[model samples]
Target chain A: MDKWYVGVDIGGTTIKLGFVTEAGEIVTKWEIPTDTNNGGRNITIHIGQAIKSKCSELNESYDRLQAIGVGAPGFIEMKTGFIYQAVNIGWKDFALKDELEKETGLQVTVDNDANIAALGEMWKGAGDGAADLLCVTLGTGVGGGLVTNGQILHGVNGMAGEIGHLTSIPEGGAPCNCGKTGCLETIASATGIARLAKEAIDKNPQTTLANKAEVTSKEVFEAAAEGDEVALEVVDEVCFHLGLALANIANTVNPAKIVIGGGVSKAGDHLLNPLAREFNRFALGRVASGAEFKIASLGNDAGIIGGAWLAKQG
Target chain B: MDKWYVGVDIGGTTIKLGFVTEAGEIVTKWEIPTDTNNGGRNITIHIGQAIKSKCSELNESYDRLQAIGVGAPGFIEMKTGFIYQAVNIGWKDFALKDELEKETGLQVTVDNDANIAALGEMWKGAGDGAADLLCVTLGTGVGGGLVTNGQILHGVNGMAGEIGHLTSIPEGGAPCNCGKTGCLETIASATGIARLAKEAIDKNPQTTLANKAEVTSKEVFEAAAEGDEVALEVVDEVCFHLGLALANIANTVNPAKIVIGGGVSKAGDHLLNPLAREFNRFALGRVASGAEFKIASLGNDAGIIGGAWLAKQG
Candidate 1:
């Protein structure tokens, strides 16, 4: 009899589910549209029903599911598995673990979504089983997950890997959404990259980017790849801060791997090459020798896979 | 019938020893001059003979000794207990653990001096037994040790807590001994404070600090306490860099406590008050709320006490 685990990744738009085997195999995976009406009350019920349907389709008994692990985007109480706040999902002070457990009659575990993504990479993706790794996601806002000794460092308040908020310029830089000025997120996120391109184009009327009404992160990378001076400068500034931030973390944690993910990372070697060069310039020589950089491989499936890792750990 | 652990803190000029009971009691302690002649070959023998003599003085046989733990100021190989380098002691690639074990006929463990100091503080000093803490030593240079889940974070290559090497200014900052420029140590260390004071006084000849023959970190703090303009500016600058460095680390690790140690910490509230203010200003509000700042209480005994902790763990 093969035991199974249900890994769920709850997002604002949709919920991803995975029926994972003990050996880290995903026998089946699917998604359901998130029902956020009425404070997300129907979210857990939808997930429960989806899990049952998946088990039936696979011709496996639901009893084969030993546990359910969930990855939710918010501050989570480690002991109670409560979602302190998930602004995207309209959840606050919700006992998500208890709700899912009651609805499905199964034990449940929950953790922050970013942390689970890092664990997913470590378990079956780019980390390649490295126990110490740092996973950085560069989307609308930068997010980070630090794994030490094969476990997530949740810190005292689940704010351990808030690398996005690190003060890069330290003086008179851009303002941040967190009510702080000169935060790394102000310059290195996807939104930050587009903002930088727009600012540069606005200052100089000759830039090719000026022809477009609005610039996106993808357009910025593309313009840089095509040797647009404005876009190149933006990429350089972004990589400079990203490198400094990564070096700071490397000096602190000496992680074996630094994995970059999310939309900005789609720039690929254009982002990684300069970032690695900058990282080498800032990182202590010994720490640099032990660490290597890689692009994240698990894309959207990272959350569910990381949830599986949590289930296995629980 | 009581068993005891022998803790040794090896320094360039002297060695500190402690005979500790299993219950974390230091029954007796002593110091011995270190003989670095002949490549420091006789230092371990002296430690072994001293431990034996101490046991005889207390009317107890060496058979009562459970294990020996050593705190050496160098990069140590955790598994083999090798001292990769101790420039002060002229030791390189030395099998310190094997030598001590062979000489004393007991199991032995070795760790970095700063790490042992942090362990000492956590076990019996200001950490108050908190499992997650970051201890920073501000001396000739800055040294840091991070304890998480009640154990040291050794990282992949034993360089996890190299916080001093983090690029603080990230641009044109002071040069460090590690062949890097603008590191946190170049601005936040005791030496850095003295240097900053000298530079500031040189630039403004009318300041009170300009009259001093030599500006030390202590003099700068004293002048700041008395409201000296140049000294106050220097203090602010040092605290600014120190606070930013700490906040960056706090954002990364979110340790429950940040413990300051070493000589510069003697300035007390003069350094801490400003540092706490800057740290809170930069730290994520949630992390700042959960983390507290404290001065290390163990002083010089921290090394030997931490060594005893390692012995107990072993």
Candidate 2:
């Protein structure tokens, strides 16, 4: 019988699930709405039933499922698989692995969603064949994941890849959601870019961005691509901070590859070309050219793919 | 007959060698001048001859030497043991390992001096049982070594633990030897402390430091200990920057312990007390209490001891 692995990515709004093969190919994938009410008490039941239904729909036996891996947003105890906190899902101090295992009668593994994504990239995406990779996701907030020696770097408190919280500007950096000032996330996230564009437009109403009723990070990149002075300045400033942050991390971790993912990364070369240039300027001369930069290729499926990889490997 | 390992710590001014037993005890140790003339061409020859002579003096045959480990200041090629560069000793792209191996007729291992020191600490010093540790040597310039999972973190270009290069102040920061401005080394190193004291005295001529022809880091700490206002400010600033840098790294690497070494570390609690307070203030709530701070205990013998550890484990 062909063994199968299942990956579950539990997010605030939706839970994405994928049935994957040992070869890292996703056999099938789907999503279910997340019920965050009652502190996510019904989450395990939903996941268990969904897995059973999905297996039945594919005419596959439940015994064929070799393992289950979950990617959740928060700090997780690696040994116990207990979630210390998942702010988005209201899962505080919950035994997610044990709960899911009991509900489905299957062994389960759990990790941070960002970590699994980096693992996914290393397994079959941009980081293919590379064991040491740093993946930064620029969504509403910036989240970073590090894969060293083919394993996630879960620091003492499972906060190892919290690069978003690193003080980028130190002195006058914008406030972050994490109650800090001048964090990398305050400038590198998609929301952060929009905020910067809004600030710049407020200062000078002559820029093309001033015409937009709602300025977005994508529009800022689009205008910069067209050589708009203000937009270009904004992009340059963003790249400077992001590149500096990457260089600092490179000097510390010396990763072989830095993979950029998230909605903002859609800006492509307009983002990568300048980022690479600035990264070199900040990095030590010897390490400046050591790491290769690449846009993440797995898209939205990265979470599920990464979770499956964990299950397969575990 | 019990076998022994030879550890060699190669510095710009001196070469320290030790004959260590399997239990990590140094039976005997000695030092010799480092002949850097002709681009350090004769360093390996001297090391080999010294090792042979030392064995003869102890009435031990060459057959009793099981392995040899070398600790040099540079980016070492892990597999080949080729030194990419060691600016102080003027060695660039030198095969120190192969030459010494040929002369000694034994298997050899090589690593960065700071890394070897960290290994030594982990094996027998402050980081005695901790598998993950970040050891920083605050000498003229800051050098860091990371030991993760009982192994050195030699990044893609051997730049792992280059925490000294991390930007401490993003704007109007001091220029660094690494061709950057406002590095942690610019604020936390022995030279950086003296520079800070000098700048403070220059601004406020009434301070006692202003009368000194040479303002040393030790004097600044001593004055601070005595409640000298200007010196206290300098210490505060230094602690703030060093603490922030450590907190940032703590969030990223999350090592079990942070061991402080080098000449500047001699200040003891005068440095550690303020640094701990600031580190907690900047670190994420979860990671704030995760790491323990300790003074490096091996003193100058750390290098040779670390080299022996590599020889024993390699």
Candidate 3:
């Protein structure tokens, strides 16, 4: 259908709204500040206004809109259309989907933001046409989605692909938000990489990256590109951890392709090469050979595209 | 659809055959010797004579047979109907489908024995009706299978589920056939448990189980039940590794149910209780609250049932 669909990518501060077509082309998009206070009513109204404003701006009737898809950042109940738990949003059991659907008067589909983003990429990004896929999003937190046999594996509950919280280091690790230690999220996420950079800065004062003011993982990559040995070591170590996680998953499921998304995957071949090498060392034979991982192609559009696909599922 | 079908569980020695229904019910099962050396042609002859004799004994005609489903132990290509690398079977890229079909004049379906056994369980056993499932056979090796939305999750090459080779302890523990160290199979399989028992017996010569003439996993379980300290330690150790592996899989996939089968699972709740407790300790909070696990239900009938189902997938 040529009718437009609304996709909302909910984040801590800005909520990205996109009117995308079934062909995965974004027609128009905008962002609005998320207001969580006063029972999330204002946020619901904002969503409706944004949909109405976009349709009106294009001289199109609201009925011309096909559906609304919300990529809620954390735990979500697709059955009830509620945002169950989002630490960033501070909303528990928030009827975000139901309220949005009621106000917008459109079919609304809501799921974990990362799962939708992974689906987005699978639809038209790096992992297109792959029936078996595992998508890892290395953002503030490591969120993952596993698609098998053309459908997302949502486990018993909605929390099927919680690979970040997997206990990699059984005993010692950095404390995580989920009250766990030594999770993939604690080491491989952009936030985790920054934490590592911060630790290295404290330990090695002679390092070039250590001399930089307010160091970030991006700065670490840049410094590493310029031959900073410490930065290189940090990257290698981080990739080793990521590789172990991928190998563990590979041995179990043997997905056809692993789509790496989020800001960090933009590190490109630098990350991809090491990830492939280390995964080769760890993954079981045939499982490692069967699945080839690639950098997610959709980049920022993965959320919008995957959200549309999720709506199509409904 | 139950005119008659041959369900052969091809092992290293015995070939167990049964007449199975489309509904997965096994009837008039019999066994015959597996002769892989007389050039694959002899296998069909043996299977034919055994089935004919069985049919004559039951006053049924050979013409009443419908199809044949073979469960061969090793890596198999279900789609191509070939056996790739079952070193024990002495078949490398053998066209089992064509050979069996040509000989028997009936359609044939073949797959890795463990995978078919899991399909059997998924179809009619403990995992019946579950949308997503992980089946682990804890025998000499920790063979596994993944079923998502009621279908097997075979990767590009049909080598989808190989969980045994997953390195549970990253650094070092025990050696694996795939040249890995500290794999889940090394610590938790039936062979692993027997090794642990032997090591304990060697170290603690005065212990109750140590004094036994021959130490098997069954003997170890028996000792543990009689409150032998050494037996208890070995059992606990095996279950500990199993718990880690299970939790790792659960955290990654979060399947609806996990079915434990093979020789080791016969220990039942003695092993399952400790395994579940340890899995809870290592699993993500959301997963610990969800994901049901139980012992496999079909027992020996799993092969015939799974084969019948795979044959139906034709």
Candidate 4:
């Protein structure tokens, strides 16, 4: 390789790996299904093989290779190369970097998946040219990352961007999977949207939604598009909570812009317009003018692109 | 002629001046009464005279002095150096830096009081060596500063660190001077403490505090220490709100440490222990573990020292 690096985005269902160049561009990328029941070490070996298979296809005697960068979920101890309890992977104190290195013999640098994805989004996506950026992933759960002064900030033990767990309502409300009530994720993520829809269905059984088998947020959105009252109610609540939570996040970060991505954000202006109105109402009037709320553009490609950008920095 | 900087800390009642060196130490400092009603130009002349008078006493040449750094209570419009709105001084768009330069023949840099104080504390006080720090000034009006990777964050329009205005309650709990209702400042600041004490006195007029002509937080703390039930109850409410506010802040910044200063911090363990306990209940598990709360070590001197430190950085 004249000059090349690798970027890995590990999620619950699939692990996306990319071969990238030095200018924050993705040359090639591939995805592999993740089977965590095979154990963490086996997963690392598979990821290494995926990287090697892609690098070999470049078809040149490599002069040198830059470092490989990884975006991981859960608490990644940057110094120890350990994953301290990744919930989706069912891993605790997992020797992630060591296992990957043992299989591929390449030095690895890992960070919280959201942090690197934010870097990717900032360098190439909606946050481009912004110095202060906050990127939030509205997936099965809410993931957050903060970038200030052109650098990712991780508190000691890599727990800096835990905005999902921020208390949205201190009193009794929806139960979060994190074993906490009143968490922001309990009210705004894809899972949270599904929960809100399910609750509405249970509370109002006469709605057309009850006639359908197996409720999904997508179906709810589709119903709302067709003018179903219950679905519209569910979406309005989601936007309301999301708006308040965004306002709170704005208060704290005062970032130039906030980028929202993942499955739920696909609701588009139906979700965004109300959220903008609410965030403005709650955000301090002085700094409220600075923050721009936008739906994240990269979608599924954010991981590879973010990885490529981070790898360039590496 | 060695490196010399004049550090000015302007408050409602006094303007503190210091000669600071490049090593972040205040060699000598003095305080003079400030006349806010006399206009910005008069204040500028008073500061210059204070600096010149100090130089004459030490037989130090005024020509050796570098630029001045001012920590004022308000919004600063960058190098133009106008006071956008110093509520304490009733100033709005006053050209403070230009006035001072013309009067004293020296260049100047100006910033909000809380931001400058945080810089001072970070340079030499409780937050020394902290890569991520959030300082909350617990005064008549609560204010804050955010430093990530050793840089002060000033959001668009220089209003980034308005933590005091973050809504703790959704609406209509108590009114704030900023025209907001149920803000964190309404329940957790020194003015808040006085209000809480006043409420207690109204409820339990038979208590010893009722005899006092003018009640203050200091008197309430004294009464509580003397085993007054109403005083203790009011204090407990303050602690609870303070904890919830800090927990919310912890979720946002995820700082390595939170330095509590200004007058109310003097309550020490009497307030800190309860606040920490309540904060634990509200903060996310991972983030709460990453940060420690501590009383600001620089105490009353944080403002002066912080201004001095900013001068050195300049």
Candidate 5:
């Protein structure tokens, strides 16, 4: 009989759930709109019911369902699966693993969403089985997950892999949501890119980006691809810092692969080429020689897959 | 009967050796001049003879010796103990562990000198049993070793802990021995400090250091202690880069303890206070909250002690 694991990814708007085979195949996946009307108190109950109904629809015995792995946003207690606070999901001091286990009658494991995404990449995506890997997502905010010796480094306070918060400018730079000035998040994130594009447009009204009422990171990359000098300059500045930060990270951990994911990464080689040039110029020669960069392939499914990995490990 | 392990720390000028118990206590320690005249070919033989002679003198049989651990300065193949190069000792392509085990009828383990020192600290010095650690040594050159999940992270190419080579200046910085520019070693190292002092003196010849025939890092620290304006500025600059690099590293690894070691570390609180200030300014809040910094307590004995730790683990 084939055993199955339930992988759940909890987000602000919706909950993504998948039944994954022991071999990392997604047997079936679906989504449910997040019911956040009551501080997300009914989340576990909804997930439990969803799993039972899905099993019945597939006409599979409950014995085939093994364990559950969840990826939730915000601060998490890895051992206890306690949610210190997930601002997006309106969860505070919630015992996610305990509640889920009680409702579903199975064991559960929980980890940060970003970490699980990295684990997913490591298991069945871009990580390619490299034990030491660094996965950075260039989304609204830059998120990072570091894997060393095939285990996620949660740090002492679960703050490890906070690569986006690295102080890149180091002096008199933009303020970050983390209350720090000049963090890499202020430069390399999608929001940061758009902000930089706005600043560039403000400085030079003759550029192609000046014509667009609202400049997005995608528009900036597209303009740069079309040889717009202003957009190219902005892209250069963004990649320079991104490359330097990634190189420094590679120097410290000497990862075998650096997987770049998220919306801004959709820039493809336009981002990676310049970023690699800067990374080569900044990283220790040997470290640069050892690391290979790849675009993340899993996309939205990374979280559920990584959750399955966590459940499989458990 | 208590078994004993032999720990060897091979340096350019001398080789420090020790007999340590499984509990990490050094029973006895000694040193010998390194025989680098013949490309370090006789090094293992000499160590083998030293162990045999010591056993005879102490009236202990060879059967009581358990294993040996060696700390060598070089690019090593960790699993095979093959030294690809050790420029200081003129050794290349040497099978250190195999030769040592053949000469002395015992098992052997080998690691980089900096890594062994970190292990020594983690075992009996200031690491306090914290599983994840980052140990940085500031000497003629900066050296680093990273521990993740209680195991040394020997990245894909054994360059994981090359923190000193992290590009700090990124542009128009001094060149390093590793053929890079603006590496952390070019600013925070003992040699770099003296060079910075010389540059400061050239610009402002009215400083107290202008009176000295030759200025050293020690003199710079002393002058700063005595309120020399130029010296204080240099200290601040060095601390700024050091703190920024450490903060960035902490953000990546989220180490529990950061152990600062080596000769330049002798500057003590004079160096730590300002470094801590910059560290707090740059590090992510939770990361800074989780990490505790400590001066390396083992001094020169860290290598041999770390070697003993390796042998004990083996």
Candidate 6:
């Protein structure tokens, strides 16, 4: 009988789950809608039921499963797998690991979603097994995960690798959801790029961006690809700040690979070319020489894959 | 007979050596002039001879010395202990570890000076045994070292903790020795603080600073303590940039202890108070909450003590 591990990624809207082998291959993957009712108390029960039903449908006994690894957003006590608060899931001080283990009758490990994604990339994605890696996810909000000496840095309070919250604008910058003003998330994330485009259009409605009903970060990159001045200016501003922030991070930790992922990264060369130039300009001469940039190849599978990695480690 | 490890801190002007026990106590310490003549070729030979002579003077056999650890200022290949360059000592591509091992007939370990100082602080100084720490030395030039998971983070190319080279004033900032402009070294170092004061004094001849023939960083801090408006502004500027840079670093690594050291650290509360405020202002609320700042207590002994730690590890 072959052994299997369950990898779960819990998000606000959906929970992604996968059955993975010891060698990191996903046997099968699926998603279930997150149950936020009753303050998300039913989340673990649903996950447990889903896992059992999937195993039965595949004619596999529950004994074939070895352990479980889970990824969740927000402040986590990595050792205890306790959630101090996960605003998206309406969970506070939740014993996620204990509950999941009880429900599934298996051992479990838990980590931050961003961290697991970074681990996934390190194990099977753009990280290429580099011992030191910096993975930035340019989603609705900028998210980051850092691996130093081949291990995740959870910090003193599990708040390590909050790269998006780094202050890009020291004064009079836009407000961020994190209660800070002018954070990198306010300028470099997907929403930030769209916001920049909106602000530009508000000032001068003469550009090609004005033709769109609502400009997205994708449209901004598209316009820049065609040499639109306003779009180009916005891209330059975003890359300059992002580049400077990354350079500072590189100076601090000196990672060998910087992996860019998430929806905003879909712009591909249009983003990488400008961002790389800025990174080189601001990084120390030697730090720049040592780092290589790569687009994340794992895509949406990163979270589940990363969750699988945690299980594999266990 | 008791065993001992030799710790060496090599500088351009002098080399500090210590005979340390396994328990991290320095039995005796001394200094010898660094032989920078002949392109620093004789440095290792001098250090080896000094260790042997010191043992003879103390009526101890050289056999009692277990191993040696050396700290040098430069870009080092941490694994092989090879020096890429140390401009102050005129050493380039020097095999520091192999040469020292051959000269002394003992195993040897070598690390960057800044890194050793950080490790020393962690072992016996202000770090208070914290596993994750950030130590910044604000001397003639700023230097930094990072300890993660109770080990020094040498990074991919041994350039991990280059905090001083982080770009603070990303645009039109003063040139740094590293060939970058607007580095944190240009605003927060002792030399940088003095430079800021000189520029301010040159622009306004009627200030209290004009009364002094020379305005060093010390004088600037003293004047600020006395509430001189010009000096106050300079102190504020330095702390703001320093605090911001530190906050960014904290955001990345989330250190539990941030140890500030070096000549400029002598300003004490005059520097710590304002710098702490800026650090809190710029750092994420949680990262700020988790960190405590302390002045480095080891002073000049940190380098040799840290070097001893390297030998102890060996």
How well does candidate 5 match the true structure in TM-score terms? 0.97
True contacts kept of 4: 0.40
Error of 1 at A255 (Å): 0.8
Best by DockQ: 5
Docking class of 4: medium
Model 5 has a clash total of 0
Q: What lDDT score goes with residue A156 in model 2?
A: 67
Cα lDDT tens digits for candidate 6, A137-195: 99999989999998888888888899999999999999999998999999999999999
With candidate 3 superimposed using the best TM-score fit, by how many Å does residue B142's alpha carbon deviate from the native? 1.2
Model 1 interface RMSD, in angstroms? 0.8
Stretches of model 5 off by over 4 angstroms after superposition: none
Using TM-score, give the best candidate's number: 5
Which digits, one per residue and each the tens of the lDDT, describe model 6 over residues B1-314? 67898889999899999999888889999999999888899999999999999999999999999988889998899889999899889899899999999899999999999999999999999998888999999998998999998899988898899999999999899999989899999989989999999999988777799899889999999999998889999999999999999999999999999999999999989999999999999999889988999999998899989999898888
lDDT of each: 0.90, 0.88, 0.82, 0.77, 0.93, 0.93
Please give, for every candidate in the order listed, the TM-score of chain B alone compared with the true chain B: 0.97, 0.96, 0.91, 0.88, 0.98, 0.96
Q: Which stretches of candidate 2 lie over 4 Å from their true place?
A: A1-3, A37-42, A60-64, A102-107, B1-5, B19-23, B35-66, B87-93, B102-106
Q: How do the residues A1-314 of candidate 1 rate in per-residue lDDT, one tens digit apiece?
A: 88888889999898999988887788889999988888888899999899988888888888999898899987799769998888889888899999999999988999888999999999988898999999999999999999998989988878999999998877798999998889999999998888888889879878788888779998888888899988888999999999998998999999999999999999999899889989999999999999989999999988888888899888
A1-314 per-residue lDDT for model 2 (tens digits) = 67888989999999999998888899999999999988988999999999999989999899999889899987789778899888889989999999999999988999989999898898889988577789999989999998877788887667788888877766777888988888889998999999999999989889999998898999999999998899999999999999988888888888899999999999999999999988987788767777999999998788888998888877
Candidate 1 residue-wise lDDT, B1-314, digit = tens: 98898889999999999988887678899999988887888988998899999988999988999998899987889879998888899888889999999889999999988899999999888887888899999998999999987888888899999999999887788889988899999888899999898899879888878778888898899989999988899989988989998999999999999999988999999999999999998999998998889999989888888898899999
Q: Is candidate 2 or candidate 5 better by TM-score?
A: 5
Put the candidates in TM-score order, highest first.
5, 1, 6, 2, 3, 4
CA lDDT, candidate 6, residue A175: 99
Candidate 3 residue-wise lDDT, B1-314, digit = tens? 34666788888787888987666778778777778784444776777678778888988877777888788876777777877766776677788788878777778988888887888888889997676788999998888988876788786667677888887777767788879888888878888888889999889987798677888788888889888999999988887778877888888877788999989889888888878988887888878777787899889888988887777766
Ranking by DockQ: 5, 1, 6, 3, 2, 4
* TM-score per candidate, chains pooled: 0.97, 0.91, 0.89, 0.87, 0.97, 0.95
